[model samples]
Target: MTVPDSLADADGLATFAVATVLGFEDFGADAVVEAVRKSLPELADEYGEQVFAQLSSALRGAEGDGASPWSRRTRWPSLEDRVQRMERVEYAQLCRVRDALTLLVEASPALALARRAGVENSDVRHIEAVRALNRRTDEYLRRAEAVSRYPAERAWKGFTGLLLHVCSSPGRLSTFQQDVTVLDPALNDVPGLGRRVLARCMAASDGEA
Candidate 1:
């Protein structure tokens, strides 16, 4: 099976959300709550409370109407709101809020897959854009030193890294793609690397060796 293309892909995100919910139904909500709490202690007085409330609600796994946890429409508004609010807050405050939110999203399938692939929370903390998720995926593989010349393994590692680097860092994408061109000719433009990588992660998470 293949992984989802991106977190923004509605179907992909939805599938991930469902998979995550089914997989981690037993997870305590306390971690989510604590992430917010630990982050808030250092926020500037003016915006700390507001950011806390927004993040808390977003991570609570329930909508205002008591529906599902991460309906794209419901979750984005809250996340977007926090993002916009952070712009007006102090730098430290913004960092804290971002950290808290990032931690919460880790419970989602998108980041969960990264974790399953062996990425730690710290690995994703520096993501500045949505594309960073893909970049981080590549980093996970690279850190594992799992890149190989075999068709399946090399295509999986190098190509996924290429896709991620291209998505997250567009300016550097050209150079990276060129580098990848020298490495794996088969993965020129499949457009399904994300899905493929995600599938690999799912398998790994299920303890498949």
Candidate 2:
């Protein structure tokens, strides 16, 4: 399954963020917002003022009984909305947005945590560990994408089990602890990369999370 490109600069990023936040069942708006900001810094750098302003405005609107993206009666912007927004952006801006989106999607939280722990990709142990995590993550994502053709219940069970395995794998956790003082370096600073991956999965499966 092919993932659609993020092409509308801050507008596109903001839309994706809204969709993602809702996709997670709006787990915690504050937490989700911070994670979205941290994970996609390029959006901030490029259009920090407007992007954040839009995000703030959206949040303010989501308060109390106000309809939010998560509300069934108030669905998030559609593909057409995104396309229209993208069409309004300059070509250069769109290019930058595309690049930023690519980085955001490619970033791996496990790798980020490893970097924070000072584990260089140069070391064989570090390389292997990183490769292992990446390979496993990719495998699951690919399977998730392909399994869309299957019935909903079967697909959900398969993805659920896959997520549980990935989240609880002792060997994977142990590798992350190797040569690192912090057991989980990203706990304080960065958002869980796994959360981002799951968010993408949720989006692909139409908010299944």
Candidate 3:
């Protein structure tokens, strides 16, 4: 089903490979093949486990030498090759994080808050470090604002504006540990805000409301 990366595309071969690798004895290969044919374009170059998960099926199918199309799936094991691939994946993750942080910085209250908090030299230096990673975020925001004509667009000359603000020091990170985490399930795993208590601490700084 995959656009015949090679000439010997065989029916059910891709699916059969998947089922065998999955250890499903009677899994129908034809069904899997159709699904792969429809989805391979998106999944083919996907990162990390996604690629290997799909490969598992093809790998299973290829176990027995045959004209099966699954036999044609790519294989990789060289240490140097894996290292390069890992670097690309890490690069992508970094971009996503930087973009999200930039998006946060471009918002107003966060900017005002950071500006007020970042008066000192130490704070100024920390903000600079964070900005180094946010160059792309500025670009995305510009394109977004130009198309939509939002007021925030007027504020952000570039990502550096946001980066410089966020790079300011976090105001002496507390070393004390606390059990408090998230009260809301939706916000779990979010970084930087290490604990839910930071919200309460911020509220106290602002005086009740």
Candidate 4:
């Protein structure tokens, strides 16, 4: 469904931003369904009955017998299946980014020297951006771990807090892309080294290293 223009307000915008970051793949369908339900009354009050009716109709069409609208769009039929898929995707992405960052960190000393020597390049800025993203990700992971012990409602609040912390910065996402595009090929010419680094990252992620 088309997002209504009425969502331009602060609260609406924040909700849209979170939903955009969460996407259909990254988070569970239950969260999206819950968000939609929670926002409906507020949206109706802020906008008008016509807008609310349109949104409600759209959502009704999208939803099914206790199934998320997001689930209907994808092959995964159950919340468990979707959660497993998200975990695998998140793990792989984390490993790749970690491996790339490791390489950047190893080269940081030389990059520093180059900066002192009046040698400037995009690598420095890219590295800085990626580093910021990495720091934020690490913080989010820590928060997630702490909240895992909390009850479901509190846990969800913690999750959304982490999401806001990570997704609120558009530059963080862009810089990560810049670093990956420019530095990911640094080890490509040396297949063995590339494999070794990636293997190390995977092992570390699996708690085997």
Candidate 2 lDDT, 23-107, residue by residue in tens: 5335444544555564454344333345655665565456544456344332344557545644655675445433322232233
| TM-score result, candidate 2 | 0.24
lDDT of every predicted structure (CA atoms): 0.39, 0.42, 0.39, 0.44
Give Cα distance to truth, residue 28, candidate 3, Å.
Answer: 4.5
Instruction: Tell me the spans in candidate 3 whose CA falls farther than 4 Å from its real position.
Output: 1-25, 35-42, 47-79, 85-97, 101-209
Model 3 per-residue lDDT tens digits across residues 83-200: 4544544454445544554434333232234445542233223333433433223223333333233355554554543332222212101100010111122223333232323443
Off by over 4 Å in 1: 1-30, 33-56, 61-65, 73-144, 149-163, 166-209
Global local distance difference test of model 1: 0.39
Worst 10 residues of 4 by lDDT: 40-49
- Candidate 1 residues 1-209, lDDT tens each? 33443443444345444545653233334444343344323232323355455544654555333555444222222455544543545565334433322322222344435545764332233321223534433433342233332356564565454333233332332243333232232233223433554666767678865
| Candidate 4 C-alpha lDDT tens digits along 28-147 | 344444455444433332233454444434445454443344433323125564344345445555555545444433443444444444433444444445445554333333344455
> Which stretch of 10 consecutive residues in model 2 shows the poorest summed lDDT?
175-184
Candidate 3 residue pairs that clash: 17-57, 17-61, 18-57, 126-167, 127-167, 127-168
* Alpha-carbon lDDT of model 4: 0.44
Candidate 3: C-alpha RMSD to true structure equals: 19.3
Instruction: Report how far residue 149 has shifted in candidate 4, in Å.
Output: 34
- Measured against the true structure, the TM-scores of the candidates, in listed sequence, are 0.24, 0.24, 0.22, 0.24
RMSD to native for every prediction? 16.5, 18.0, 19.3, 16.4
Report how far residue 148 has shifted in candidate 3, in Å.
28
